[model samples]
Target: MKSSAATDNSSHHVKCDKNNINDDGNNSFIELPPNSRPLEHQIAGHFYDQSKTKYGLLQHSNGDVLKPLLNPPRGPCEEQFYIDVFCQTSKSKYNSEDLINLRKFLPHYLGTYKCQKMSYIILENIIQPFKHPCITDIKIGRITYDKEANEEKIHRMSKNSVVAEIGFQLSGWKIYRSKYYEYHDKRCVRSLNKTDILHGIAYFYGAPIHLRLDVIELVINKLNELQDYMKQQHTFVLISSSLMVVYEGDDNDQELNKSTFVDVRLIDFAHVFPQTNSNQSDENFLFGLANYIDYMKQLLDKNYVYVPIDKFEHDNKTDTKIYSCYKQLLT
Candidate 1:
C-alpha cells in the first residue's frame, strides 16, 4: 500500500480555486513535467483520442496520479470530498471510523497539484504495485444520477437498462493473460447482458485454480470490509461511481509474500452527495454492493466458470486459453 506521509503535511491541503483551472478544451496553454504521462489503464472519464498529452489522468514519476479538475460543480465536489476524508480537522464531523476506514478502499489523496494555472488532484496510483494488473471498473448503484441531475442527465442514466436491472454496470475491463493485455472497453461492455457480465468476472480471475481461488477469496474479503464500512455510515450517497478491482496477472507468484493479492478500491467520486434529507444509509449503493458481493461469492463456490471465447475465436487467437472449471477438472 502507498504511504499517506505525502498528505500528512498541511501544505498539501491547498484550497481549490476554480478560477485557477482551465476547464476549456484548449490544451496548449498547460505544461506538464517531463516525467508525467497519460495513465495507460484509465478506462473511463473524459479523454482525447487524438491527443494523449491534453486530457485524462497523468501519472507522475513518484507514482502519484494527477487528475485534472473538470468543470464544476463536479470538480469542486470531488476535491471537497477528498479533503473531508483525508484532511479532517480536529472539529470535523466526518472523523468517525466508518468514514475514516474509507482510506483502505480508496486511493491516497496527497492533496492537489497545480501546473501552468491548471489544477489537478494528486492521488496515489492504487495499481502501482502490480507488474501486470488485471483491472475492471464496475459502476455501482441502480440509481446512477443524483437528485441534483437535470432531466437530460437523468434520462440518459435511466436509459441504461443494465444499471437499472443489475444494480451495477461493467464499465470496462483489462485482463492480462497469454502474455497480452485483453481490453474490453466501454463499447464492449455496453453489449453484455447479465450473464455475460458474470462471465466477464470469471474471465478476470481466469488462471490456475489455485491462483484463481486465492485472488477471489482476497477480493471478496475486501468487498465485504468495504460494505461493512458503508453500512455503518449515513453521511453520504455515492452515485455514478465505480469499484476498481485489480489483481496481479504475472506468472510469478509475487502475491504469496504480500498481505493481499487483490486490490479493490472505490473511484470516481464526482457524483457523491451528502445524505441531508434523511438519516438512512445509501441503499442505492449498498444494494449494488450486496449484489456485487453475491456474484463474487458465487465464484468461490466453483459451481460454474464462464469464459467468453467468441471474441478470441473471431480474432483467430486459437492458442490463447481461458481457464474453465470443466477444463481444469478434465486435465
Candidate 2:
C-alpha cells in the first residue's frame, strides 16, 4: 500500500506502567482521595492515561475495572480496509454531478448490517450503482463510465467524466453526454435526468387540492424569476427539456395576511442554453411569449388564480373569467 510521508510508526503501540505493584503482584492503583483534588479534576485524572498523555479511563477508576475508550474507535485493519475499498470503487465508477448527487442515497440503500459488519463491503458496494432503480433509484446509471474496448471513441466527443450511460424501460438503453457548456465546472459532474422531473410532477399532482393553485402559481413564478435573473445577467434562458420547473412552496409573508406567492425551482441543467441571434430572434420571442400568455390565460379561466402584478394583472371580472374560459376552449 502507498504510504504518506507523515505516517507515524508509533501510533499503533500501546503503553502502560508496570512498576506500580500491589501485594498480589498486580498494579496497586489507588484513586485520589476526595479532598486531594476537585471531583472533576480527579475524574479527569482517573480517565486520562497520564503516562501516555492520552485521554482514556484509568484502571483504578471503577474499582480495578478496565474501562474502555470513551469514544468508539475503529481498528487499524478496519480503517485500511475501508480506505482501499473506497479508492478501488471510486476509480471504477464514472464521475458526474448527477452521479455525485445520487451517491448521497448509498448509505441508506446498503443498510446497517452491511455498513457495520464489513468495512470493505460498506465502501465497495455502497459506492457502486445498484442493478435496479428499486435498490438505487438516483438515476446514477445515466452517467456511468463505459468499460468497453471502444471507450476511446465515446471519450473523444464526450469526456468519460461528465457523461453516463442510462437504461430506460421504454427506450431500452441510451447514453447521453452532457453538453460541453453544461459542465464547465468540475463540481457539476452528476447524472440528473428526466426521471427527476417526472418525480416532481407526480409529487405536485398528488398534493392536496387546496394547495394546487399555490403550487401552479409557484411554478409559473419561478420561470418568470429565472427569466428576470437571466435578463439581468445578460444571458438568455431556454428550457430545452419540458421538466425544468418544480413547485416548492407558497410565497406569502406570515406576519401579513395577504395571499402568498408561489415558489418554483429549476433543476437538471444538462440541456439548458442561452439564446443567440442565430438560434433566437425577436419574432421567435414574441411567438413563444404569445403562446405562453395564451396558456396562462387558459389557467386563469379555469379559476386558477395567479399572483396579480402591475401591467400584467387583469382588470374586470369578465376579462379575468375569460382567461380561465379560454383555457378550457383550447382543451
Q: State the local distance difference test value for candidate 2.
A: 0.26
Instruction: Evaluate all candidate structures by whole-model CA lDDT and list the values in order.
Output: 0.72, 0.26
- Candidate 1 residue runs with Cα over 4 Å from true position: 1-31, 48-53, 90-97, 207-211, 254-258, 307-331
Considering summed lDDT, which 10 consecutive residues are worst modelled in model 1? 322-331
Reference-based TM-score of each model: 0.83, 0.23
lDDT tens digits by residue: candidate 1, 1-331: 2465534745253343444434466655344444677776666665533344456688887888888787789987887777777776554445445557677778878878776555788887988887778788988999988888899989988997877877988777777764567666665566667667776677668733333777888888888888888888888889988999988776476555456567899998898876774567888999998998888777777566566544323233332333111111111
Candidate 2 ranges with C-alpha deviation above 4 Å: 1-211, 228-261, 272-296, 302-331
Candidate 1: lDDT over CA atoms? 0.72
Work out candidate 1's RMSD over C-alphas: 6.3
Consecutive 10-residue window with the lowest summed lDDT within model 2 = 180-189
